[model samples]
Target: MGTSTRQLNIGFIGFGSFAQFLAKTMTKQGHLIRATSRSDYSAHLGDNFIRDMDEFMGLEHDVILICTSIVSVSEVVKSIPFHCLKKPTLFADVLSVKEHPRQLLLQEVPEDSDLVCTHPMFGPESGKDGWKGLNFMYERVRVRDEDICSSFLNIFEYEGCKMIEMTCEEHDRLAAQSQFVTHTIGRILSEMQLTNTQINTKGFEKLIQVKESAAKDSFDLYSGLFIHNRFAKQQMKNLESALERVKGLLEAKM
Candidate 1:
C-alpha cells in the first residue's frame, strides 16, 4: 500500500471478522476507526467499540461503512437510526452481493447521505499479504459529496487494488459466473472430505487449497451468494449440467 493520501473518520456498522480485518489496514493508513455491532467487541476493538447504536450514528463520521453479513444486512440496515446522524455522510457497504445492498441503502439511508455500493472481491485470507492486484468493485449509486466519497475510495486505490467501476446489476451478474461458482465448487470439494495423500499431484494440491479456503468462511456467506444474487440460480444449474455432461462422456467410453 502507498502512503495515505487523505485521512477519514470511518465508522463501521458491524465488527465481525471481515470488518476487523479491514479496520487493521484502515488504521494502518491513518484513518480514525470507530465501530458498533450487535455484540460487544470491546475486547477486540478496545475503546473503538461503541455499544449504543444511536450514539454511534450521532458521532462525526465522514463515512459509515456497513460490513455486516449478506443475510443480516436487511435487518441491520432497517434497524439503524438514520435520524441520529449529525451530518451528511457517505454510506458504503462491503457485502459480496452488490445489488441487494445497493437497493436497500438507497431506500433506507437519509436523503442527504451519499451511497456507494462496493464489493472487495478478496477476503482476509486472500488479502492477508496485501491488496495488490485484488479486485475492488464499486458503484456510486448516489453521491453529492464527491470529496468525501473520493477519499473513501482512495483507501482501496492506495492499497494497489485493481479498481473496477461498474453498476451493481452488472457486478452481480458477473460474480455469479465467477466468484459464486468458485465457492460452490470449493464447497462441493470440502463436502467430499478430500485430503492430501503421500503421493499428491499438483492439480490435487490446488484443489485442496480451494477446499480449505471455502471451508474457512461461514456457510451463511455461501448461501447468501445464492439467495441474494438473482443470477446465481442459473449458474448452479450450469454447474450441475456440466457435471452430468462430463459423466456421460466417460460412460460412453466405458
Candidate 2:
C-alpha cells in the first residue's frame, strides 16, 4: 500500500495546539481529520469537529491519535468510550513520555485495537519550517494491523523525519537524560531572567534561545516531564549534584 495514494481518516482525541499543527500537514497530504476535545474547536476544525465523545468514537477512523497532555492521559483515557468504537482502530499517542500512554492504552483500549506509542521530539515551534531531520521515536507495542500502522507512520517518513524504533522504557530513560535535562536547564535560565548583552558569546546566545523556548511552553508540560517519567527524578538529582560539584571546585580554587 502506497502512503501517497492512501487517504486516511485520522481522528484526533484532543485538538490542542500540537494536534492542530499535525493536522495541518496531514490535511495537506489529503487525509481526512475529525477531532473531539474538552474545548470546542468547531471554528478551527469546521464540520469535522465532533463535540460528543461517544459520537466521535462511533466514527470509522483508520487512526485515533491521542494528543492530550502527559498529566491528563489517565483521566482522558479512562473517559474514552471504547465500546462505542465501530471497529478495532489503530490507537496512537503523541505524548512526550511514552511508557505511560503505552501502558494506559493497553489497559483501556479494546483488546482488538492496535496500539502504537510515539513521541515526535520536535513540536510546532521547531518543525514550523519543515519536519526534515527531526527525531520521531515510536514503539509498536501491540500493532497487529501492519498496513494502517505503516501508512500512519508514513506521515512522518514523508516529511523526512528521522524515525527511531525503540522500547517504551528505553525512550523514557534516554528522554529523562536528554529532553528533561534540557527543559530543566532552560526553565532555570528563564527563572534567572537572562538577557543578551552587546558582548554576548555564542554559548550565551544559545542559552537565551533555550530560555525563550522553554518559556513558550506551559509549565504544566515542564512539570509533567518531571512527574510522569520515573527516570526524571534521578536526572534532576544528577543535575543538582553536578552544579554542587562545580561550585565546590570553584570555592576550593579560591
Candidate 3:
C-alpha cells in the first residue's frame, strides 16, 4: 500500500502458485498488473491472461515478470519477437537460479530495456511473511529505481525479514550451497515417517515438525533448486563425498 495508484502496467508470464502470490502482493501496492496463463487462473487479474503470443502483441506493459519453471522459461523467452519488445520493459523472474533466466535477459529481452532478474526465495506457506525471506536481484537496473525494490524491502523488513542482494553469478553460486543443502535435507526428512510419537526427542521432533509444516510447500518447486540449477550439481557431488566418508567412519565403528 506504500505506492500510489499511478498504475504501472505489470505483466506476469506465468500464473502458478508463486506467480499468483507475487501478483497479489504487487497488486496490493497499487500496481496495474496484466498477467498471462496457459491454464485457468483465479486472480482478479485473470482477465489479463493471454494464451497465445499472437494475442499479446501491442501490449504496452512496463514491467514483465516471468514466474514460470526452469523447464518452460526458455520457450517463453524464445517466443518473444524482438520487434515486439520495444517499450524498454523491465524483466524479472522468480526462478531458483539465473542460468536460464539470465540467458533470456541477455539473449531475448529488447536490448535497450532495463532488465531486472529476481529470485523469490520463499514460498506459499510464507503468507504475509513471504517477501522477507525472498532473495532477489535487479540486474543492470538503474540503482535509482528504489520504488520497486525498496517498497518490497520495506514490506519484508517490517515482517522481520532480511533482504539480500547480489549479482546473478554470485546468487547462483551461493544458492547452490544454501538451497541445494536445505532441499536435500528437507527431502530426506520428508521421506521418513516416525511412528513413535512419544519416543522422539524435542530436537528431533521439532526438526521433523518443521519439515512436516514445510511439506505443505510444493516439493516440485524445491526440486528446481536441486535439479535445474547447473552450479548445484557440484554441491551434490561434494555432499555425496562427505556421505561416503561418514559411511567409512560408521563402518570402522562397526
lDDT winner among the candidates? 1
TM-score of each: 0.96, 0.97, 0.81
Candidate 3 error regions (>4 Å): 1-6, 129-138, 141-161, 194-196, 217-220
| Candidate 3: residue 240 lDDT (0-100) | 89
Alpha-carbon lDDT, every model: 0.94, 0.93, 0.67
Residues 1-254 of candidate 1 have per-residue lDDT tens digits of 54456889999999999999999999999999999999899998788899999999999999999999999999999999999999999999999999999999989999999999998988888899999999999999999999898889889989999999999999999999998998999999998999999999999999999898888889999999999999999999999999999999999999
Candidate 1 TM-score versus the reference: 0.96
Positional deviation of residue 230's Cα in model 2 after best superposition, in angstroms: 0.8
* Candidate 2 local lDDT, 87-179, one digit each (tens): 999999999998888889989999999999999999888999989899999999888999999999999988888999999999999999998
Model 1 lDDT at residue 159: 94
> Over all chains combined, what TM-score does candidate 3 have?
0.81
2 or 3, greater by TM-score: 2
RMSD of each candidate relative to the true structure: 1.3, 1.5, 3.5
Q: What lDDT is reached at residue 85 by model 3?
A: 58
* Residue 74 of model 1, lDDT score: 99
Tens digits of per-residue lDDT for model 3, 1-254: 12233456777787887777877766766777677777765445555777665555458876677888776777877876557654566676778877657876677666666566666667676565545444444344433355644543444354444556677778888888986777776667777754346678888876776677656657666766766677888988998899999999999998
